[model samples]
Target: MSGANKVQKREADAEPVPGLFTLVLHTHLPWLAHHGRWPVGEEWLYQSWSACYLPLVRVLRTLAAENRRHLITLGVTPVVAAQLDDPYCLQGMQHWLANWQLRAVEAATMRTASGASPASEPKALRQFGSREHTEAERELAEFDALWRHGASPALRELLDGEVIELLGGPLAHPFQPLLNPRLREFALREGLADAAHRFAHSPTGIWAPECAYSPGMEAGYADAGVSHFMVDGPSLHGDTALGRPVGDSGVVAFGRDLQVSYRVWSPKSGYPGHAAYRDFHTYDHATGLKPARVTGRAVPSEEKAPYDPARADAAVDVHVADFVETVRQRLSAESARIGRPAHVVAAFDTELFGHWWYEGPVWLERVLRALPAAGVRVGTLSDAIADGFVGSPVELPPSSWGSGKDWQVWSGEQVADLVQLNSEVVDTALSTVDKALARGGSLDAPTPRDFVADQILRETLLTVSSDWPFMVSKDSAADYARYRAHLHAHATREISAALASGRDDHAQRLAEGWNRADGLFGALDARRLPGR
Candidate 1:
C-alpha cells in the first residue's frame, strides 16, 4: 500500500486507544455570604475565587475555544453555588479584588529613600508586586466580564456549550453517611433542584460530599435520578478499572484510580512538591505574596529560593510529559489485566489547582492538551458511561475519601460532640416542621409559606455540613469550624424551641434574624419536608 493508504489502514484498525481517562474536580465551600471575614471565613471564599476559580475557568474556556467537549466533570456544591450567586458575596468579591490590587500596588511602591531592606529584597518585592498587580487586573476584568452576575451565567455557558459535565451534590454538602434518611433524601433532591434552577439543567452525577457513601445510598441516587457518583478506590477494593453498578440500582460508582491519580498528588510526593514549583506556605509577610519556590522540602521560608515563572513552566512541561506517560501506561496495563478497555478516573479538589499550587493551572492546561496528543482518550464520567467503561454490578462498602478510607474523619472521637449535635439538631428540626405542618388541622392542607420552618431547615442543614467536622478532625481552622457548628446548632435549637412552645412571634423574629446570614436555597419548601 502507498504511504497514505497504509496510514488509513492502521487508523481503521486501531482499538479505541486502549481506554478512557476522566478528571473529576469537586468544588465546594461552606456558605460564607454574611459570615465573618479575615483569617478564616469569607477570606477563604475570596482567595479561592481569585486564585482557583478565575484561572481554572480561563483554562477551561481556552480549551473550549478549541472545541474540546466533555473535558472534565466539575462538581459545584449547592452551598458554594448559592454563595457565588449571592448579592452579598458578589459585592464582597469585588471589594476583595480591589483590595488585592491596592495591596499589590503598595508593595510595588514600598521602596524607601534609605533602602532599609537589602537591595535584592526590595527589587524582588517590587517585581513580585508588579506581576501580581497585572494578574489581579486580569482577574478583575474576567470576573466583571463573565462572573459579575454570579457564576451561573458562566457555568451555564460551560454546560450549554458542552465544555464540561457539571455534578451536583447534597445541600450544604452534609456528610450523608450519618444524616437522618429523610434529611439525606431531602437535601439531595433540593440540591439537584438548586442546580437545575441555576444552570437550567439537572446534573445526573455528583461528587458525593467527601465521596462518602453508605450501603444502599444508591437507592437515594436512583430516586434523585443520579446516574453516577464517585467513590475512593478502596470502596471497591481497589478494583477501579471500571464503574460498578451498586446493588440492583442503575446508579454507577466510579472509583478514583489511585495509581494514576497519586502520580500528580499524594501524601508523600507529587508535581507540586517539585523544586521549581512555587511554595504554597512560605508567604512574604511584607508583600503578602508567596515569593519562594519549594526548593527543598526541609528548607525554611527565609532560605527558600525565589520563585521563577520560567522555571515553573519548565517543571510543568516535564510533569505534563510524565503524567501523560503515566496515564498511557496505566490504561495499557489495566486494559490488559481486565481483558478489555478499562477506565481511569482521577479526582481532586478544584481549589488545589491555583490556591494550593500556583503553577497548577498551567500544568493542568498542558497535561489536558498533552494526554490526547499522547494517544490516550480523555473525557468526563458521562462520556465514560456512554463509551462502555462500566463493568458488572458490585456492591460498595461504607466508605469515604478520608483518613483510613472510612467515616472516622467526620465521626471519629475528635468530632463525637459534633456527631451528637448534628443528631439532636436534625431530629429536633424535623419534628418541629412535622408538628407545625400537622397542626394546620389537615396534614395535606394548603397553608401559608412556612418561613420559620424554612429557616429551621436551613440552619439544620448548615449545622450538619461535613466541612465543620472534617475541619475539627483535621485540626485545620478547628476553632472557626466549632464556632460555625455551634452557631448553626444554636439557631436550629432556638428556632425549634420557640415554635414548639407556642411562641409564634418569637419564632418568626428569630427566623428573620437568622435569615439575613444563612438564607440560601430559596427553593427549600418546608411543606415538602417528609415526616420522620
Candidate 2:
C-alpha cells in the first residue's frame, strides 16, 4: 500500500468510537562529559548513546527514507544538547564505541581460548565456551557495529530533516515550578533560544523538566515563544480530550497518558525488568562491566552470568507487540467514548531506551513499525494541537513523575538539607541582584552583568536539576550528588557574598570558578530579565 494510504488506514482504525491519542517522548540527560568517566558520569553518557540516541536517530532516518512520515516529537533539553555537541562528549563517545569493539574482540578470544584446550583449563572455566558465551560475543559484535560510527551526523540529520519535531526545556532540566519566577523565566527563554541556534529549528513546545507543572509556568513558555508544553494525565485532572491553555498565555498543555506510558517503563515495574532483558546493575567484578539477565529477582553478584543479547532481543519483540496493542486499544476505546478522536499520549524518558533499559532501542523500532501495522497513527504534539483538540478547563495541581507523581522525591525529608540549601542559595543570589541593581551602579565598581549573570547561572543550575536529591534518596552515588549540590551551592553563596562585600577580585575569581565548573548555560543572561 502507498505510505499515505497506510497512515490513513491506521488513523481510521485508531479513530475512537467517540477521542484523539498523542505520543510524546522526552529526551534528556545532564551534562556528563568532562566531569567523570568510567565509574559513573561519562559512562552514563556513553551507555545512553549506545542504547538510545544512536538507535533513535537510525529509526527516524529509516522512516524518512521510506517517505513514511512517522510523526514523533522529541524534547531534547539544552543541558543534554550541550553535552551531545560538546567536543569532549564527541571524543568520549568515539572512544566508548571503540572500547565496545575491543570488548567484542576480547569475548571472541576468550571463547576460542576455552574451546581450543578444554581439558587443560580449570573445570569452572569450561563454561566459558558454552552457547551462552558464544551468544555474548555475537551481541557485542552487533552492538559495536551499531555504534562504531559517530552520532553527530545522525543527530544532525534528524533535526535538519525535520523527521522529528524538536522540543526544548530549561537549561539543566530544572524543576521550574518551585524555582524563582524571574530566574525560571530567564532559563526557559535562553534555553529555547539556545536550542534554536544549535538545531536550526525554533521549538514551539517544551518538555517541562520531570513533566512537572505549575499554574504560572505557561507565562514563561509564552515569553520564550513556546506555544505548548506537556504534563502527566493526572495533572490535567484525568482529561485528555484537548490541551488546555494556561491563563492568558497562548500555550497548550498536553498531558501524558500514564497508563500507556507505564506499559513501557514505570518507576516500580515495566517491560525492561522482564527476566529476559539485560540487567542494569550487577556487573562482572573481573571486567567491571554489566553482564547478566534481569532474572526477575535480583541474583547474587557473584552468580550473575555474562549478558546474552539474543535472549534480550526475544523479550523486546514480545514487549513491542504488547505495547503496540496497548496503544491501539487505548486509541480505539478513547475515540469511541468521546464520540470524537482522542489522543493517547504515551510519554517517557528517552534515557530509559538505551541507558537503563538495554534493549530499549529494539523495542522502540518494533513499536514504531507495529503501530502502523496495527492501525494506529503516529503524530507529534504540534500536530495534535494544530488539529483543534482543546483540553478541559481544570486547575492543574503541582506534580511530577517523581515518587507518588509529586514533588516529594525532590524535596522529601531525605533531601531536606539539599532542598533547603538550594532555596537559601537562590534567595541569596536574588537578594544580591536586588541590592546591586538598587545601588544604581555605585556598588563598588558595580557587579559586571556577566558576573551577575554567572551567579544566576550557577544558582539556576544548582536549583534546577532534580538529580541531586534523587541520587541521595535512591542511594545511587549519593556522595557524588551531594558533592555537586554543594559545589554549585558554594559558588552561589560565594558569589553573593563577594557581590555583597563589593570585592572586585573575589567576585571575578568566584565567577570564573563557577563558569569553569558548570558552564553550559552561557545563554542565560539574568540582566535580560525585566527590571534586572
Candidate 3:
C-alpha cells in the first residue's frame, strides 16, 4: 500500500489508539522588562521571544489555517504575559531585532574587509553573521505586522481558533507550597483574571509553577475555578496514563509522561544533545552568534565542528519519527495493560525548542503534523477530560518536577538562606498588610488600599519567586538572582516600616519610587485581594 493508504488502513485497523496525546509547553520568565540588558536580563526575553515565540506563532498559524485544532497546550504565566504586553518591553524588542540585523550586516562587512579567503574560515562561522542578519530582519517584519502592539492579539487569535489551549498560572510564578494560603489564593485569582484581561478568555487549567504540590492545593485550584493541572509523573506514582481526580474537588491532575517527554529533553541523552544539532553553550562573543554543533563530550571549542543546518534537518526528521513511534507504542502498551483508553501528556519548557535546540520549532511542526497520520489521536488536556481521560481517584504526594522529584531544589540545605529569606518577607508583608487593613476596617468590605500596602504585597510576591532559589542552587545567574531576591526583600522591609511608623508621605514616596521599576501587576488591587 502507498503511504497515504497505509495511514488510512491503520486508522481503520487500530482501536482508536484508546486515548489521546497532548504536548504541553510552559512559557515563563521572571520580570525582566526594566531589569537591564546584555549578558542576562531583558536580552533573555527578546532572544526567546524572537527565536521561540514568534516562530512558534507562525507554525501554529500555518496549522490553524488548515483548521487544525488543539495543536498544543500553552501555559503563559501572568508575569510573562504582563511583560509581553508592557509598552516599554514591546518597543524595546523591536529595537533589539533591528540591532540584530545591524550586527549581522557588520559581520558580513568584516568578512569582506579581512584579507583571508572564505576557504580559510569555517563555513559555518563565515555564514553565521549573515544568517543572523537575515533572521533578525525577518523577525522585525513579523514583529511589526503581528506583535507591534503586543503579544495579546497574536495569542488571542490562536486561542480563539482553538489552535492552542491556554493554561494560566499565578502571578510572579511563586513557589505556592511555601506561600501562605491567603497569598496563594490571591495570586491564582489575580493571575487568571490577568489572562482574561489579555485574551478575553480565562483558562480552565494551569501549569502550576514547578508543578509544586502540597496536600490541599486541589481545593485552592477548585476555588480558583481551575479544572485541571499538570504535575510530574512521579506525583501520581509514575502512573500517568490519565488525568486523575484529586479528592472530591472535580479538579484533575495530569501527570507528564516522563517516558515520552524525556525523549525531547533530559539531563543526559535527548534529541538536542545529538552531535548533528547545534551546540547552545558555544557562542561568538564578538557577534553574539552561535555557530557550532555538539561535536562530542570533552571536545574543546576550537576543535568543535561548525553547525550544519542540512545535517540538523536530517536529524530532526529521524527524531520526529522516533518520537512518534515511542508515543504510539507507549499508548498501545498502556491501553492493553489498563484495559481502557490511556492518555499521554508530554510537557516541557517553551524555550527549549528554538532557543536551545535551534531546530526545535521545525521538529515540533513536523511531529504535530505526523502524529495523526500515524494513528495517534492528538488533543488538548480539556479535550482529553471531555473524552474520558479522567480516571480513578489518586492521593498525591508533595512533589515537584525538579531534581529528585521533590522540593529539595527550592527548600534544600543549599538554599536554606533563600528559603528563610522568603519566609521572613512573606510573614512581614502579610502581617503589616493584615494589621493595616483591620485598622482601616477594610477587612470587612471593599475599601481603598494604601500605596504602601500595595507595594509591600508586590515586593513580597516578587521576593518569593522560585527562580531565585533555583538559580542560586544551580549556580546559573546566581548573582542576579541573589540581587533580585534581596532587592525585593529590602523594598518590602522599607515599605512595611514606613507603613508602621505612620509616615504616610514617606511611604507614598517609597511606593511611587518602587512602582516606577518593580511594578508588574499594574491592576492588582490590594484591597480587593482576599486574605486568611
Candidate 4:
C-alpha cells in the first residue's frame, strides 16, 4: 500500500494508541415546552433540537454505522429528556420547524419587509433564506420519519451500538451541593429512573449538574449506583490526568482537562470567536435568522459581514487542526508527568457545537477522525473507567464548574432571596406532602397518590432548578427566570393550601389544570417521595 493508503488503513482499524482522549457533552435545558416562547421557551427546545440535537446525533450515528466504538459520553439531563419526550413538545417542535420553512420563503419574497434589509439594502439575505428553508425542510422530514417518538430512541440507538456512554442527572438539574440531602438523593435516583424508563437502560455514570461536588457527594453516588462522575480540573488541584476516588467511596471522579477544553471554549476566548464563524448574538429581526459572522469583537451586529460557509469551513479546518495538536501535545506531556498513559477529558456544553458555535460540529467530526491518526486513542468516559484510569482517594472541597470555582453561582449573595425562597418552597412542599401522606387510610384522607401531591412536587422541583438562580445572578433573562420560579412556587402553595383546607374538589381542579401545563415525569409518583 502507498503511504496514504497505510494511514487510511490504520484509521479504518481500531487499536490502542499513545494516550486516551474522551469528550463529554452535558445536554440540558430547563423545562421549556408550554412554558413560554419567543424570547425564551419552547423556541429554545425546537432550536436546539433542530440545530444541535439533530446534527450532532446524526454525526455519531454515521460514525457508529462505520463501526466506530466509544465516540463520546453524553448526559441527556432529566428535565431535558422530559421535554424531548413530551407529546406537546414533539407536536410544537414540528410546527415550529414547518413555520421556519415558511418564514424562509417570506424572507426571500419580502427582504424589505424582512428587517435584515432595507429597500436600498442589497438582498444578500435571499441566499440565507434559501439555505435555511432547505435546512428546515431536511430537519422536518427527518423529524417526521425518525424523531416523532422522541429523542429517547435516537439516543438509545447510539447507546446500544456502544457509540456513546449515557450519563444522566437529576430531574431538575438542582445545585446538589446546597440542596437538602434527602431531596438531592431523591432527585438523583428519580433522574436515573427517568432515563431508564425512557431509554430502557440505566446510566451507571452521571454528569452531576454543573459538575458540582461537596466532599461527601461520592457517598451519595455510591448509594445511587453511579460508578463515576466528572468534576473540573481545579477540583483535583494537583494532577488531573487520572480519575480519583473521592474519600472512601468507590465511585470515581474524572477531572476535565482544562488545557484541552479551554482550547475550544472559555469565558474570554475560544475557537467560536474566530472571525469567520457565525455570530450567535446577531440576527435578522424579521425572520429571526442569523446572517452575520463574528467579524470582530467591536463590530456591531448590523455592520458584521454576512455569513460565508466556505470561509467558516476554512476556519473550522484550522481550528480542528489546532485542537487536534493541542490534544496530542497535552496527552504526551501528561503521560510524561504521570509516568503512565494518561486520560485527557475535553468536556463542553453540547449546545456549543451547532447553536452557539456554527462550525463546532464540523470541527468535531474532523478532530475525532483525525486524533487517532495522530497517535492518540479516543474513547468514552466509561472506557477510561473500565480500563482502570483511576487513582488514590482525593479530598475535594465543595465545588461547582461555575464562576469563581465554588458554590457562589447557585447560592451567591447576588440571589440571596432565591436561595431563601428555594429553602422555603422545598420545605413547605415536602412538609405539606408528608402531612397529607400521614393522614392517609381514613375515608376523608386524600387517596394514596392524590397526584395533586405530584403536582406540588413537580412544580416545586421546577422552582428549584439551578437555571433560575444562575440566570438571575447573570441578569440574563432575570425577569423571565423570576417569573418561572414564582409561578412554580405559587402552584405548589396553592395546591398545598387547597389540600390542607379540605377543599378536595378545588385542589383536584388546580392539580388537573397544572398537570396539563407542567406534567413531566409520568413515572414520578409523589407517594414515593422520600422527604419530610
Best model per lDDT: 1
TM-score of 4: 0.95
lDDT of 2 by residue, 243-351 (tens): 7877667688888887788887777788988887767776533333455667656565455544556777888888888887787778777777777777788888888
Could you tell me which 10 consecutive residues in candidate 4 have the lowest summed lDDT?
113-122
Local distance difference test, candidate 1: 0.88
**RMSD (Å) of each candidate, 1 decimal:** 3.6, 5.0, 3.0, 2.7
lDDT of every predicted structure (CA atoms)? 0.88, 0.70, 0.86, 0.85
- Per-residue error for 463 in candidate 1, Å, reads 0.4
1 or 2, greater by lDDT: 1
- Residues 405-466, model 4: lDDT tens digits: 88898988988989998899888888888887777657776556657777888888898999
Please rank every candidate by lDDT, starting with the best.
1, 3, 4, 2
**Model 3, position 399: C-alpha lDDT score:** 93
Model 1, span 1-532: residue lDDT tens: 7643544454455455698999999999988777788788999999999999989889999888766778889999999999889999999999999989988887677674212223226667777678889998999899899998999999899999998999999999999999999999999999999999999989999999999999999998998899999999999999999999998998999999999889889978888999989888887665566667898898877777767788889989999999988888899999999999999999889998999888888888877777776677889999999989999999888899999999999999999999999999999999999988777645665666789999999999999999999999989999999999999999999999999999999999999999998889988988877666
**Model 2: CA > 4 A from native:** 1-21, 111-156, 247-250, 298-301, 304-307, 434-452
Please state the error at residue 245 of candidate 3 in Å.
Answer: 0.5
Lowest-scoring 10 consecutive residues by lDDT in candidate 2? 111-120
